[model samples]
Target chain A: MKARAFSYFRAATIEQALDAHALVGDDARFIAGGQSLVPALSLRLQAPRLLIDITHIGELRGVRREGGFLRIGALTRHCEMLSEPLIAEFAPLLQAAAPFVAHPAIRNRGTFGGSVALADPASEFPAMTLALDAEIEIAGPSGSRRIKADDFFIDLFETALQPGELITAIYVPLFKADQRFAFDEMARRRGDYALVGCGMLATCAGDRINDIRISFFSVGNTPTRVKGAEATLIGSSLNSERIAAAQAALEGDLAPPENDEVPPAMRLHLARVLLGRLLGRLGESA
Target chain B: MSGFDENLLDEADETVRVRFVVNGRKVACEVAPRETLVDCLRNELELTGTHAGCEMGACGACLVQLDGRAVHSCLMYAVQADGARIDTIDGLSESGVIADLQAEFHRRNALQCGFCTPGMLVNANELLSQVAEPSREEIRDALSGNYCRCTGYEAIVDAIDAVAKARNEGGSAT
Candidate 1:
């Protein structure tokens, strides 16, 4: 299926993109890499009257370090997450999850910010953001403001972004020496959406866990932070007993919706299995 | 706003003029805002090698090189590709850039129906350019998007593996 006919506007600057989107309001959408939006358009799931081509905007490009955080521009492609040295050194979790985002062709065109903005519950980067405790930078008609990743994702395919606002960049706190990251997803195929995916960043002190953030996707409406499980591992060693406790805690943290293919019980079982595997890996790294 | 801004298409405009380099040739044409690059390349530009399989990003059948990177041409509007350089399977084959891989594929009988050959070739070329010697697993991983109903993909992987070995050993694939 082809997309509905819509006016295309190539914005040279961030201001132009916001202005163009403002002109049409809800009828317009800012297109970054068009990986997801284009598919939605073709499927007629979304048909905006105007497509603000934000790819040409210079302000939304590049990845750089600022103080203690790595500022990754919204236009950073998924492929860059794997190849960019700054991201590899500063935010290795994203690099670990990049290959599972999609295939090479899709990764070549998909943007990190676009994926987060789309807030697909089955996506990797959005969940990783929660684990990394990243900040989402937004440019709106009034002014620019940053939103924490936890507050940015509201629901499935819904974000905190208001009408006519554009995501400018994502800021992740730099990875430190004490941090250990692990990411894995179970999927029927290599590039297909995960049956249940997880990414975690653990801060350890010697053999004990200091702090950890565990985020799971495809388990709920939004990328969920399993506080119950995190609490189970805090100040404890990632041994089999602790890992089992964390896995059991997932029963309260996650409530997989009933679906035709995978029942809720089966999904929760997979999440437990995945959590145990990730925690085991994190323990080895520590 | 500058006078150049006046050239921008309005919301009411049904067609927009776009120009891009295809296979090293500068080509300009008028296209509807909804017209995808795959459609434009096949219909207007007459580059039939770039097939439109799913018309969505799922099928790699419509893969093309936009600015030297493999992407789904069906996923992008032609207007968005204005001023960008595009390389289609027709262009890549004519240029002999992936001739060795093509020869190896032919030798292995990698393709039967051949609907997925162009995309596989384009994607394989991309993988080989990036990784000189990719493991069979890597090759399979790279070709995950390029689905083939026939040949069971074993031959396709074998063909790519052979090409990578020949190229790495500093020998001709033929």
Candidate 2:
């Protein structure tokens, strides 16, 4: 595993990190926990000339509740999210799905900004981001800007972020008491990446599904929210019929972008199973 | 791997000086930009007890103590450990519970070639340190990432259970 030689810059704060990034431009990369980046470097998959280590940035490591929204810092590790009380109450979808991330050790190091910025279709966080309508807060030279969850993801392994921009925090809305949430994923192993996953946030008025948001992953280039399914369920009573219709809509919308990980048929089949089980749970909760 | 971070991983080799307390001594060393902590420990520092089976993060063979918490050294860059504390298997080799774990593993024939014993011991010790009365399922889940092809996991689980039981019964603290 031979990688090209490069220099390491330890940035202790976001200001320091941004300064380093602005100077180095495309030559430099910002490393948070190095959970994913280090492995890629070892495999010779990527070779940048400079590295800006963001692990020591104190401001980027926290989870706090501000009024009606929970602000999760960019460097908040997955394990940290599991223990955060605010996430448990407001964004339980993230809490419930976090255990299914890789393994305990990996989750202890993998960061919130790292996963969302990388925008891996199979990652559990991206789907959760959409389901909760989370706002992605990023830092650039001019300062910070917030992006809507639907607009944050652009393409495969690509985001709307500019080269020098850095994600500093994520803000997810607190659900009303009437809302019910469920997250599910299918992986070959206990700690492996999901083959296909779904995060559902549905509000029930009586037995009718008033508001529904279903984010589907591993079935597209970027994990996407299936609005058709949401529309099909909205105002409809929770039952096998609505769920079946939603599943059908999601299955028809499935497009995995043609990868070697799984054939198209397998991807669609896994998406169906996962979404089916997730809606089933919603049925029980509703 | 779309989740792979290009900035940290793809960067070039920079020999950065870092100081850390390993085992019990403070040491200074120069590490390349992309050099992993596991490679630095095994190759540079000669901490052979902290083994490296899979260079990737899948296998927990390169587990080590970072400020009292067990972490996968492979996933961390050497420069990231500046001023940090590391406790390797060598540090715990002489401890009673660790020795007992080694002995029980031997008694149960948990290893065929003994390649994964050090890592499994570290992971098991870390788990038992936190969750003293971990259920069998918990033990299994904790050790899932640390793989062993030679011996079945039954003996390994038995060794861990016996050690836990002994410690609970207050017999010799072994």
Q: Give me the TM-scores of chain B across the candidates.
A: 0.93, 0.88
TM agreement with the true structure for every prediction: 0.98, 0.93
Q: Which ranges of candidate 1 are over 4 A from the true structure?
A: B1-13
Which DockQ values do the candidates obtain, in the order shown? Answer: 0.59, 0.38
Estimate the Cα RMSD of every predicted model relative to the unseen true structure.
Answer: 1.5, 4.0
Residue lDDT tens for model 1, A116-193: 889999999999999999999999999999999989989778899998888999999999999999999999999999
Cα lDDT computed for each candidate against the true fold:
0.92, 0.82
Top candidate by DockQ:
1
TM-score of chain A, every prediction, order shown: 0.99, 0.96
Model 2 DockQ (Cα-based): 0.38
Candidate with maximal TM-score = 1
Candidate 1 clashes between residue pairs 3 or more apart in a chain or in different chains? none
